[model samples]
Target: MKRKPPTISPEDSELFRDAIGDVRRIEAEPAAPARPGPPPEPRRLRIDEEEALRESRRAPADLALDAADLLSYCRPGLPERVFRQLKRGEYSIQDEIDLHHLRAADAEALLKQFLNAARRGHHPCVRIVHGKGLRSEGAPVLKSLVDRVLRHRGDVLAFASAPLNQGGSGAVLVLLDER
Candidate 1:
């Protein structure tokens, strides 16, 4: 057995229509599916295989000197006076990165990143402590590596060994290009 839907009476329907004046229908679009999970991790920069090979082939003599005093380099045309001030550690270091116990490759990568970051941050001056070769076998490995890397970076305006009180011959005062 089934029951039929009730029908409205003519007068009652008229009263109901008058009460509910106008009506409309609407359709909605389907929503997109949710993403699977967290976003993918960013890729890290790495030294090219060829560049690493070239670097590995570099001889000790070719990379840096065995000098005992200050290590320095100033891009051509920069004021000599400014370089002199750097040598004297006259400029206040805004930040510093110490490569005290890091391996050569690690120190180099850290130094490159640090210099780029310093330049991007508009830091005018910074210090790098590459520790004297006191614990090193022969010449200071990190110090030599630091000297080479700093000299090669275009953002480096000038760099010189820090003053005696500031880790002389072990640390360097670097002047970066203004952003």
Candidate 2:
């Protein structure tokens, strides 16, 4: 009963046909290398682990003490007698550690902990391993840092580099305050 689409004008019909053909061609084209889909699954977050890792990353100080600044005061000019005394452990020293394997991140906390503990126990001396810093970059990081930390700590009375027999210049013996 319809009147043949009401006689769509030749131009209009041609345009409509062209559009249909174009759409058909597009749909028939090889599906674009199977466009990559979303990731397989939702990522799981480890809240506690992330928090612990973040806390660990925080440096010991808000204002990082420059290594050079630490060096200016932590001189290696301790006397040989002091070195000998440290080796003999004649001054109520608690621990003589060989810090060869300690990582840089750990050295300060260990030093502070040891000093704090020794102070409480009325311990007089302790030995530290600076390891000559031959492998470390820029003026032996551990030795310099340790020196600065010790000099700044109230518990330390004195510290000197060791003699050849006792870790040579690679180590230092620290005398802690009896308080």
Q: How many clashes does each candidate structure show, in the order listed? A: 0, 0
Q: How much is 97 displaced in model 2, in angstroms?
A: 2.5
TM-score of 1: 0.67
Q: Output the TM-score of candidate 2.
A: 0.49
Residue 84 error for model 2, in Å?
A: 8.9
- Superposed on all Cα atoms, the candidates' RMSDs to the truth, in angstroms, are 10.1, 18.8
Cα deviation at 63, candidate 2, in Å, is 18
| Predicted candidate 2 versus true structure: per-residue lDDT over 29-97, tens digit per residue | 565677788865412223433443465456354443332231222225656676456555455547676
CA shift at 107, candidate 2, in angstroms?
1.1
Tens-digit per-residue lDDT, 25-144, candidate 1: 787888999879986542222233234436545746854545466888899999999999999889988989999999998998888889767876888899999888778887788988
Assess every candidate by TM-score.
0.67, 0.49
Give the poorly placed runs of model 1, Cα more than 4 Å off. Answer: 1-64
Residue 75 in candidate 1, Cα distance off native in Å: 0.5
What's the lDDT for all of these models?
0.80, 0.60
Which residue runs does candidate 2 get wrong by more than 4 Å? 1-93
Candidate 2, residue 172: lDDT: 72
